[model samples]
Target: MRQTRRIAETPPPEECDPRVEALVNDLIGRVADKWTMIVLEVLAQRGELRFTQLFRLVRGVSQKMLTQTLRHMERDGMVTRTVHPVVPPRVEYRLTDLGASLGAAFCGVWIWAEDNLTRVEDARARFDDRQT
Candidate 1:
């Protein structure tokens, strides 16, 4: 019998449990939201922010959408929300270590986007010119 390298190198799927796979799927499902990215980034940068403060800071997000995004982040353990009793009631948000790490990772992508935006616009213009 001849043993091929591919056969020798192949790992059995049984090595991975289904529960672990489900957890990975759930994690990806959570992290894929752009709104979540924005919320996490804001919290990471500002340290702490009131709900209304965040709504204003992240231009173009509706109050409903921002609330939903914050709820999801809190559920995922990426953010911590505290409610304080005051004249009008105050809620504050901040990122967890995990969330900070996520923000740092995406900040690189955001910086890259900022630095290359002009080049990207040029490419789009050239592509449009070719199309027309």
Candidate 2:
């Protein structure tokens, strides 16, 4: 019988294709943006939300920035936007399965950051002390 490999088990750096590496790096840069991560977290936790609700949930985001972030996420297949055919034309945004998976993947990073917060701060302090 043949064994199957999982998507999480990536090839070693030396064995990775340069194009694939470039694409992955590009995707990470885009998806790891503060606004993108915040939006993803909000949607993941809240399930689905209207524009006004999202705007209120994601504090510090401007209307233009929120719209652009939603458009980008939709383009990347991470989110779905739906419009209701009502008098006010209600619109809602929700995370797609892919988006939820991405959020799950990021959970490890968030955990690491929280766990190492004090260590990181101490390191920064040591570096500053050394410079002074």
Candidate 3:
């Protein structure tokens, strides 16, 4: 028998539990959304934010969509929602340790994008020219 030593290799399906595999798919779908990534970035950078503040910071996201995304994040244990006993029932959101770790993991992807931006743009331009 032979074994792979590749550092970036994904686990063999036979080695993965079906429930965990399904959860991975679900998680990717959730985190792959534009709003979720933007929200994560904002929360990671800005520390804690009020609902209105996040709405303002994450431009182009409607209040309803943002609310849904935040609720999902909260359910995933990525963000903590705090409600203050105040005049208008103020609510605040901050990243949990898990979310911060996720942000840290994605920092590598950002760096990769920065390094490869030119190559990607050139590839797109070439592809577009071919399509015309």
Candidate 4:
């Protein structure tokens, strides 16, 4: 009997063609931040939110870190920021069309995780039982 390796459905393009390595690297580099997915999800769900709202929505994120993440996402053309001339100078952040597309991608992954979380927990419990 021979054992066969399970091939990944979406292997890195470079494995098939070297020409795609640069593109893969660029795409990975752009979204390499831990907070990027959360930010996208929040923006997707809320449409537009102020900095303070985001701080509350995403737990454990510092104000400075949130500001920096938003700035980077804005620079990457994934988010847009609007400033109001109000007394306190209100500023709001929202996903651009491009950002919304990325947000949808994140949402898809999030859904997959949520759907499989129970299975994952069960698997972990079984594994731990085996160790005991």
Give the number of the best model, judged by lDDT.
2
Cα deviation in Å at residue 121, candidate 3? 0.6
TM-score of candidate 1 against the unseen true structure: 0.71
Clashing residue pairs in all predictions, respectively, total: 0, 0, 0, 0
What do the candidate models score in CA lDDT, each in turn?
0.83, 0.92, 0.92, 0.82
Error of 3 at 42 (Å): 0.5
Tens digit of per-residue lDDT, candidate 3, span 33-119: 989999999999999999999999999999999999999999999999999999989999999999888778778879999999999
State, as a TM-score between 0 and 1, how close model 2 is to the true structure.
0.84
lDDT of 4 by residue, 88-120 (tens): 989999999998887665565678989999999
lDDT (tens digit, per residue) of candidate 1 on 2-95: 6543536886466789888897677666667777877877777788999989999898899999988888888878899999989799999999
- Please tell me which model should have the higher TM-score, number 1 or number 3: 3
The lDDT, on a scale of 0 to 1, for candidate 1 is: 0.83
The lowest-lDDT stretch of 10 consecutive residues in candidate 1 is 3-12
Per-candidate TM-scores read 0.71, 0.84, 0.89, 0.72
All candidates in order of TM-score, best leading: 3, 2, 4, 1
lDDT of 4 at 5: 34
| Best-first order by lDDT | 2, 3, 1, 4
